[model samples]
Target: MTTPTAPLILFDDDHYMYVFEDQASAEAGWEMPDEFTVGFDAPARPLSMTGEPLDVRLALAGEVPEEAELRRLVADHCRGHLRGQVPPQATALADFVAALPREGR
Candidate 1:
């Protein structure tokens, strides 16, 4: 049986990451650097599109960072990658991050 999967954002040596279809895909495609044994992987936490709050484990740099931190990281990624409004996937991710409710609100 195939394991159920969801969207994921994977980080490499660089500060940026891409939204992968799932964890398996990310693992399969990832080209790891020999210096670092493991890379960071976080659930995309795509709550805005579904309109349902999800309980997902947030992982980054071997530590669990807060959702706000994840949002900031994603925002930075989008800002750096966005051209004259081209990459629709990045645009979509930016929208998702924008839609997330502020923590403790």
Candidate 2:
């Protein structure tokens, strides 16, 4: 219902100036941070977010618990969510979809 002022906050899905709150609480939650749009964009520019904001931190806590496939997909989704248009993976996908947990697949 509201955004947290805590330093470790993430995003949700409300479409307010604040990004979606922590998504990890729901089924579709990717266990990633919901970023603030203003941080990505230049304060002076309109509708433009080109780089990681000074205030935003990209690092997640601890090692990613998911398998490589899930981690990669989640990372890709996060990048696209925050930066838009994530690039091709450095390695071959290599049965990435096949590797997902049954529930994930």
Candidate 3:
């Protein structure tokens, strides 16, 4: 039997983001950096999309100096990659974040 895969999305607090069929596809499409690793973990707080506690692991170099910017970039890339198959929940997530202002900006 084939193992089930969970849907994934690249999200940002502001700017860009997108939904993917699964984590592997998302990672491949994004060409995730070697230093970065993606995994499913319970978020510190519940997220609107999954509605359960879940977050993607993004390990990168030295404390991600500009986290906000990096997130925006990731989201932007995802938006392009996820041209089709934008799930309702993911759309809601995008819309919600789009409505928000950039952090401390």
The whole-model lDDT of each prediction reads 0.41, 0.29, 0.35
User: What lDDT score goes with residue 35 in model 3?
Assistant: 25
| lDDT for each residue of candidate 3 in 4-79, tens digit (9 for 90 to 100) | 2333334543434544454445445544343232222111111222211233223222222333443444455446
Query: What would the per-residue lDDT of candidate 2 be over residues 1-105, giving only the tens digit for each residue?
Result: 122211222223432122222322221322333433221111111121222333233333323232353334335554655466443343433333222222222
Clashes of each: 0, 7, 0
Q: How far is candidate 3 from the true structure (C-alpha RMSD, Å)?
A: 13.1
Off by over 4 Å in 3: 1-5, 12-14, 32-105
Model 1 per-residue lDDT at 97: 39
Q: Which is better, 2 or 3, measured by lDDT?
A: 3
User: Which segments of model 1 are wrong by more than 4 Å?
Assistant: 1-5, 33-65, 84-105
lDDT of 1 by residue, 1-105 (tens): 222224555444455555555554544454443212223233333211111123222223333324455566655555775544322233354465334322223
| Clashing residue pairs in candidate 1 (N, C-alpha, C atoms within 3 angstroms) | none
Query: What does each candidate score in C-alpha RMSD?
Result: 12.3, 16.1, 13.1
Worst 10 residues of 3 by lDDT: 39-48
Task: For each candidate, give its TM-score against the true structure.
Answer: 0.46, 0.19, 0.27
Alpha-carbon shift of residue 46 in model 2 (angstroms): 40
